[model samples]
Target: MKKLFIMLLTAFVFAVVNPTKSEAKVMYDGAEVVKGQTGKMTFKKDIKVYKKNPNGSFDSLVVKRNNFFKTYDIEKYDGKTFYQMGQYRVQATDLVVFKEVPIEIRSSFYNDPIYININRDNGMGSYGYYFLRYQLTFLDNGYVDHCFSDGDEGTDCDRYLGTDFKITERIEREYGMRYEISKNAEGKGVPLKESKTEKIMEKGSIVFAKGLEINGYLNVGIEGNDQEYFWVPVNLLKPVGDK
Candidate 1:
């Protein structure tokens, strides 16, 4: 009985001292870590990129600072946050992640408008209609690519537009302000004033307009409608398109 008790105590001590791999505890008392975050990041300074070894260690040096890489996953290990780029892992502290803001451009005109002309007939003796559509792709480099289709065929023109413009001053659309068509003493239309209702345009709001520039203002459509446009100060807009 004494030999059996000694063997049982020894087995319990071995079990407590050497736990199985599945029973091992991972200790982490760091900040909140997020996983599965995917985005583009640029190196803030020259840093080392590492790859995990088969023995659960990241001692393998893949490469040095390569400037930019697209992150596939974000996770925390050893109380440090790492961004996974393919098989490589980078520390989050040595990189600047580009967080994309939600941007929406809505038009008061028709949504995905399509125009059909039944008068056109193809060589196969089947009538076809024309489809007109416009698309805007916002690039990461502060530029927007505008693509529009012609009424007859397909895409007609593609151009890049600047989107770093901000409203500098308060723009007010005054109501009850009328001008007479006939010339007055000043050789210009006579202005008639009445009680005005002000529609204030918010300052510091980012805006994009047409490429047409006249005087010191840009011709901006009211709601993506080309026929109705208003003028905005050109000095407030800084073009950041590729030269």
Candidate 2:
């Protein structure tokens, strides 16, 4: 009977010393974690996601920057910290909290009513070449107006007097890689050729009439003029009253 009791005690001690997989809990560093937290991430370039193993090595996962995964747990393994994002592990430095800010440009011309140049850079080289993407000039009476000139040098006969419009939505639209526009939210996907001649606000000048945010673009009315408007990109247009 004593030998039977000793055998039972030995088995219990062995079971206690070697816990099964079902008895083990997830651990960070040397401490046990019951649950994890969550966070967001953004990237500038494509990156690979990795899965950690018990042997302190990583296995590649078929994930990239386009994959959206929120991290839930933070763990330290092999002296490096990683975010437990979903079922994958990613280096903490690889994640970022992103925010987009609008770009602003001021008129370089010095006059009572300055000529606004709506020029965009060709996607090439350092700084690239600039040509007028849209046209605007001061009227003979110093009234600001939108004008058209073929390429850069031509008669400014084609003119549109801007008018005040309403704001609905404003979105950041990109052209090539260097230029961005404030596209109207409502008129998206409808080709501009089918739309009316609305002045798209450029990076160099503010010559439009109405400053209404229709879609993702801002339709701003020219100062003192109610007949013409410039449709500027919401991301590039400066706030009103910002000197």
In order, candidate lDDTs are 0.38, 0.38
After superposition, the stretches of candidate 1 with alpha carbons farther than 4 Å from their true spots are 1-37, 57-59, 62-66, 76-80, 94-243
TM-score of 1: 0.23
Ten-residue segment with the worst summed lDDT in candidate 1? 186-195
lDDT of 2 by residue, 1-243 (tens): 999999999999989998665745543333333322233455545777777688988887655554445444343334454555676766756344321110101121111211211111212111111112133443444223444455768745533211101111222233211222333322212111223344433444533323233334444444445565444445665443323
Tell me the spans in candidate 2 whose CA falls farther than 4 Å from its real position: 1-36, 55-57, 75-81, 94-243
> Judged by lDDT against the true structure, how good is candidate 2?
0.38
Q: What are the models' TM-scores?
A: 0.23, 0.21
CA error at residue 205 for candidate 2, angstroms:
80
Error of 1 at 9 (Å): 86
Scanning candidate 2 in windows of ten residues, the lowest lDDT window is 101-110
lDDT of 1: 0.38
Error of 1 at 65 (Å): 4.4
